[model samples]
Target: MPRSWVDGLEARARASLPAPVHEYVAHGAGAGTSRDEAAAAWRDVRFLPHVLHDVTDVGLATEVLGTRLETPVGVAPTSLQRAVHPDGELAMARATAAAGGLMVVSSNAGSTFADIAATGVAWWLQVYLPSDRTLALPLLERAVAAGARAVVLTVDTPVVGSWEPAGDRVWDVVDPAFTRVNFDEGHDTQPGAEKALDLGPHDLDWLAERTGLPVVAKGVLRADDARRCVQAGAAAVWVSNHGGRQLDRAVAPARALPAIVRELADDDAEVYVDGGLGSGTDVLAALGLGADAAFLGRLPLWALVEGEHGVGRLQDRIRAELVEAMRLAGCRRVADARDVVGSPAPV
Candidate 1:
């Protein structure tokens, strides 16, 4: 079989980047079981494609939180892009815009929201509230002023996960200027600047009320948690395990998606997911499993290793692959992507 686009990009990125840099992007918490399992779980989902359907034109367009996307696949928030490439988030924003996909800017992004938004990409801000919730206000205010269409509140990392073996070396060597440039100078030294350990459902309400932008609760795995987020004023619930970086042995998004979708069956909230989703079929599987949209975490960063063009190329290829998969599965539109996966089984 030919090398997949993601595999090819990973190989090239690994070859071009320093070992530590590559390892940082690839590392998962603890035993790496969650990261390994995330990718494997999606493959276990068997596609139950319909027969004899006219799939001449497979539509990939979909609206996410009122923002229209030419493709259902979007780039997830990954930090320190400049650590791998000079252009950093700017390059990603440009490429994602060129491909007409959404880009989620990380709280720790190397570039300013103004610069990223200036790239003309439809973007959302992914945030981790600080112990002093007020610290996030300026950050949220800036992103909204920069034209962020939504806010993805990442609630998984009450504390950053422990990446054993690699430890702090993954981040210790990165220049401080290349990460979290959005915060005030010496922000880390301030009291309550650390990630809030007391994050709760009410925090979601606070963010929505404060920003006025639709809030998407990310890092949700449990159906109960997902339901609570919507109940707390979240416009959407993103099923994720922080790409297996935050919590080791957490349930993969692919495995946890069905439960969350069922939990929010009656609510008018959109469900998004990301984690080890690397192919068109993987995306198709996610949509078929009731996801409003599937996001890519690592692949875009790996593609960004070659700059904006690489990311754009990666998007084009994935879109093509998704179209083919949808056509084969008799999915003429994003909504029609449902009921294509077989009955759930243990992964």
Candidate 2:
């Protein structure tokens, strides 16, 4: 069989990158059970197609947090992007903008928020509040001033998760500019500058109130947690397990989605999910299970191996596949993808 898009990109990225860098990008916490199982979970979704319906004009248009998108799929934030390509997040911004997709920028981005905004991609800032919460104020202020449309507050990490010994990590040797360049000083090591261990729902309210921008609660895997986040002024809830980079054995986003979606069924808030979503059919499964949109993480990063052109190619392929999937599933618009998820037939 011809190689799938994800496998082809992963092969190219691995060939182009240093061994340590590829390991850093590909490895998950602990033994990698969560990371390893995520993609398989999405692939297991069985779509219940509505046959005999018009599919000649399947479209992927949708909106997220009030921003219009040509496609429902967007780029999920990933750190240390410069380690993968010289152009880094800038290339991602330009390519995503060209494709009319959203780009959620990592707090540890290699480029400044201003430069990213200058790429003209509709973007959101992903934030990890430091122990000295006040220290994050300046960075958050700068991002808002630079045109960040929303704040994606990652709430699952109180500390970095442990990865099994995998030789020297890439963060140790890359240029500081290839790491976090948004801070005013080298605050990554400053006293009280570590990730806050005492984060709470109140921080969600704080982020929204301070930035005057909507907040998305990222990394939530439970219905109660998601509910608390929405009640705390979150405009959206992102179902993720940090791409299995966080706690090992954590439920995959595909498995964790239905509960949260059911929990928020009557609420006005939008629900989004990410983690091992590789194909257009996977995106459709997410929508069929009540996700407003799906986000791509590792696939796009691997595509970044060729800079803007590569990522652009990845985006075009996914868009085409998604349209084809929709056509086969009888979904003419994004909204029609709902309630189509069902159990796969047994062999």
Candidate 3:
């Protein structure tokens, strides 16, 4: 078989990147056990192929927090896109816009909120709240002003530590002009940001009251925490392990999905999962398991690094793969994905 788009992207990215850049994207905290397992969780879950069903067309479009996207293959927030490529999230944003997909901008994103938002794609702001709420509020303000449709509050990285051996390569490669415009010291202070983020349940409600945009709590890995997020005013729960970057041993998001879906079955909140989701089949499987959408992070970054054409190419390949998977499984829409889910694929 021809090398999959995923396989090619990884090859080109690894070949193009230096040691430190490679470590930055690939490494996990501590021993990296959870990082290794993240992909396996999805790989183990397979579809029970359905036959003799019409699949002339597949409806890839879905809505998240009111934003309609061509497909659920959203771009997860990866900070310092400039560190990876000169255009950073700007290129990714434009690509997403061209394809009518969604891109979530990180608080630490190298591109300015306005620059990313200017692409005209539906974008969400991913905030890693500083220990001081005062420092975080302006960022939220800027996001709203810049046309962000939703605010994704990353609750996992309160005080994440890094173990990338060549972490400094990012600083070496990124331009000094590169900065997160929303949190510039002139706009938001940097004091106390190094400490754990001080946000709590009440803060979520406070945010909801202050910002009209939907508040989504990212990094939740448990059902109770997810429910608490809903109680605290989060419109949705983003089930993630920070790609195993924050905590070394955190459970895979896929492994934790069922409970969250079961527990919040009655709640109004939508649940999304985003660890090691790389293939269209994985996206289809996620939908089968009850995820509103599957978010793609590293692959898109690699695509952007390969230049503009790569971005659209990778996304197109993923959608095509999903369509193929859906055809084999007799799924023609997001709702049909669940119908094809079967027991875990044999290891």
**Candidate closest to the true structure, highest lDDT:** 1
Per-candidate Cα lDDT values, in order, are 0.90, 0.89, 0.81
lDDT for model 3: 0.81
Regions of candidate 2 where Cα sits further than 4 Å from its true position? 1-5, 166-168, 344-347
Deviation (Å) of 186 in candidate 1: 2.3
Q: What is the TM-score of each candidate against the true structure?
A: 0.97, 0.96, 0.94
Model 3 residue runs over 4 Å out of place are 186-190, 195-197, 344-347
Q: Measured by TM-score, how close is model 3 to the native structure?
A: 0.94
Please give the lDDT score at residue 46 for candidate 3.
67
Global CA lDDT computed for model 2:
0.89
Name the 10 consecutive residues with the lowest summed lDDT in model 3: 187-196
Q: Write the per-residue lDDT of candidate 1 for residues 143-169, one digit (tens) a residue.
A: 889999999999998888988565567
**Tens-digit lDDT track for model 3 on 1-347?**
23366688777888887656767888888888878898888988967877887888778888888878888889899876776678878888888888778888888777788887777979988876666666677778888899988888888877866775746776776665655756756544456666445668886777777678889999998889988999989999999999888888989888888788888899889999898988888888788888998898888888877666778888878888888888888877887776677874332
